[model samples]
Target: MTDNIDIDRSLGFTIAARNARGRLVRLGPVLESIISAHAYPPAIEKLLAEALVLTALLGATLKDDSGQMTLQAQTEGGPIDLLVCDYRGGELRGYIKFDAERLAEMPVNPTLFALFGKGYLAITFDQVATGERYQGIVPLEGATLADAAESYFAQSEQIPSLIRIGVTRDEHGCVAGGLMLQHLAEGEEGRDRIHTRLDHPEWEHVAILGSTIKIEELAQRDLPLETIVWRLFNEETEVRLLGGASLTKGCRCDVVHIRDVLSKFPAEERANMADDTGKIGVDCAFCSRIFAIPVAELENAGETTK
Candidate 1:
């Protein structure tokens, strides 16, 4: 990669900045590891990619020490019933629950609404220090994940927002990226009139700029952050780069963590969890990794907890 391309090892940028138009914008790239973790088809992969970028953008807005940001969807009867992804400390992981039999019958390229039918999208941020979590939920109204998120901000936060995410898969695998622009209320006067529209003209102008973004452009794997920013807002005054962060796929699931959770259960409960083969097997829904614990191991774990 050229010097212009710092080529973030994790494959994304992080920040919260205002452009010359006085709009807040955030850029983020989705890591391929998060997409390749599952052997999902291109269609599903596309949606997953979009969700990942949206997750990263929202994750970047979180406080430095916040626990994590989780983006989730619940589709009652569609092919995909559940979608959950979490981002924390510049790392993210997620999984999808879909009907294999039904999925085979789905179109090679299905629309988000078709894939999800009637459902709900939710974004949550966990505040570890205060043991409090803030969340926003919106119906799955639009045809894209970005719409769902934009709706969350508009309705829940009462902030007008625009978000765009793009996904591309080649022989090398998949790469996804996205950007978001939000209009913030200024000062005490602007804050009091939270409903008041500030810089409405600039908001529309920037929204037009945001709408012009092509999914392919956002999908650039080697494109420098500077180039993308300049290309989008070169017409406006000086655009600044507040800061950037990396995106990585990290799994916190482990044998010890699983064992510790199971240890809390009474011996009877633990026994019930064992298979006919007398092994307690657990599967991580996120990474889809399975772990089997012998009965002795479970007993020992329980003793330690006691």
Candidate 2:
């Protein structure tokens, strides 16, 4: 990497610099692990990567100790009817329900319109302690995933933000990365104070600088997230780092959960999910892990699969 960024690391981080400037950057190594774990195809991988990166950036902005955020999208006539992701405590899991027949005909690289056709993006946040929920829904008019995210803030949340994401795959694996800049109040990031700067010149200047970023540069896992920020806003003063979190491939699917879900189903329905060996088996869309429950477990209570 031309920039003095440490590319060897994979932790995702956000920068809340001075002057009401904020940027969130996620690297490939963290994202690629998810790609390998899920084994999604190229087009789906790209979509998932973009959604994951966007989720991390947006989720961090509103993260709380016991709050969970979810991002979901759906369309009328697209291959995927629904795509949803849940983020909480620096962890994420997402699933896509697609029309397999239609997906088979899609190109190796499909655009948002091609994959999802026309749809809406919905973001929801819920806090465990307060039982408080916040939701913002926006039309998916933007050609890119980041564009749709930006539109959500403009039309729903009323925040001035710019999100850009890019994904690339080589022989080794897929790498997805993105950066976002938001016009928070002039105070430093993570601070209690909030300032509204309607005429701030820095927002526009940063927007122009962010626009010049190339897809290749963002996809480089060897480039540090800080290096990307420095390359874009090195001249700016009072640059501050608002701390960061690491991301990994994780899914909540396990034998106990799977058996519980099967127990809720009637015996007849459960039988349909059973294999010839009289074991109930199902695949988790989030992580592609398979859980199998034996007949004894379905009949009464039994040990779980590892």
Candidate 3:
């Protein structure tokens, strides 16, 4: 089945397309997930959705089964401290630092460099099961995430690709959704074929259809996936199915994990916390879940995972 199959729901949908060879995939979504860690306004909420969509789109291209992808944006700007999202199996969980003043200063035309003034953007891939990880540091370029990501791909993988990303608030004005489309590396013949299609009258026609996707419609309208595909592609265009997926928030936090982190802490800090309470208090970064581990429990559990 094509990965781009439509979803029928009262909320939103995601559709992905990968060619027969699976060298590339285009994924997009209308997300309404409200993570409990922090509250965000409409604009930043939209930005987070775009970031999440981008992560999953990139994740679909991974070649290793155990590998995971992370997208991190850190800036000195207030109201928007940072945005981080991890993608695996189309599932995601992310958090952003929010600042009202910084968000107010955001111009309509934002470049990655300007938005994240004097900051770094990183993409990390890890084989969690095997404990091997690789990270790439990217200098922010252009004004949008698309520009930085495209540059990263060209520099890191030496692949030529075109990426377009859009984020908007739907009509109801409650949620955020995003769409990403990319053309991957193919031989001259394949490239020529794509160019020919782009030049075709229908190419502009498709772009026009895509333009109809207002942020309002995406946020408020609960359109079926099939309807969305039809709206963009005529019946004559064969949209070969590749796969479909749903994204949910997740975090890695457990009592043992908390204890393991506490073990690495300076004994002085541990002793201080122990003095205040019977145990040490730890919080998970991603979820902000608090775990109070008494010194007695840590002693009984051993200093490490058993």
lDDT string for model 3 (1-306, tens) is: 223233211111222222111111222332444343546665566567667656766765565645789999887643467889887655566777766776678776455555577766789988777788888877766667767886776676544334444454433333333443333323435353434333433333434545565444343334444454555544333654344455555566788677876676665667777856677767666676678888766655554444
Q: For model 1, how does the per-residue alpha-carbon lDDT over 1-306 read when each residue is reduced to its tens digit?
A: 233242222222322233222222222233566655678877777787777777777887776645799999998668998999888887778888888788888888877888898999999999787888898989988879988888898888877778887777655556666778776554425354345356444566667777887877776766765667677777765565666666667678888788778777888988898998878888877777789987778787667767
Task: Provide the RMSD of all predictions against the true structure, rounded to 1 decimal.
Answer: 3.6, 4.7, 6.6
Residue 280 CA error for candidate 3 (Å)? Answer: 1.9
Predicted candidate 2 versus true structure: per-residue lDDT over 150-169, tens digit per residue = 88877775567778887777
- Model 3, position 131, has a per-residue lDDT of 82
What are the per-model numbers of colliding residue pairs?
A: 1, 2, 15
Native-vs-model 2 lDDT?
Answer: 0.70
lDDT of each: 0.71, 0.70, 0.56
* Cα TM-score of candidate 2: 0.82
Candidate 1 steric clashes: 1
Q: Estimate each model's TM-score.
A: 0.86, 0.82, 0.67
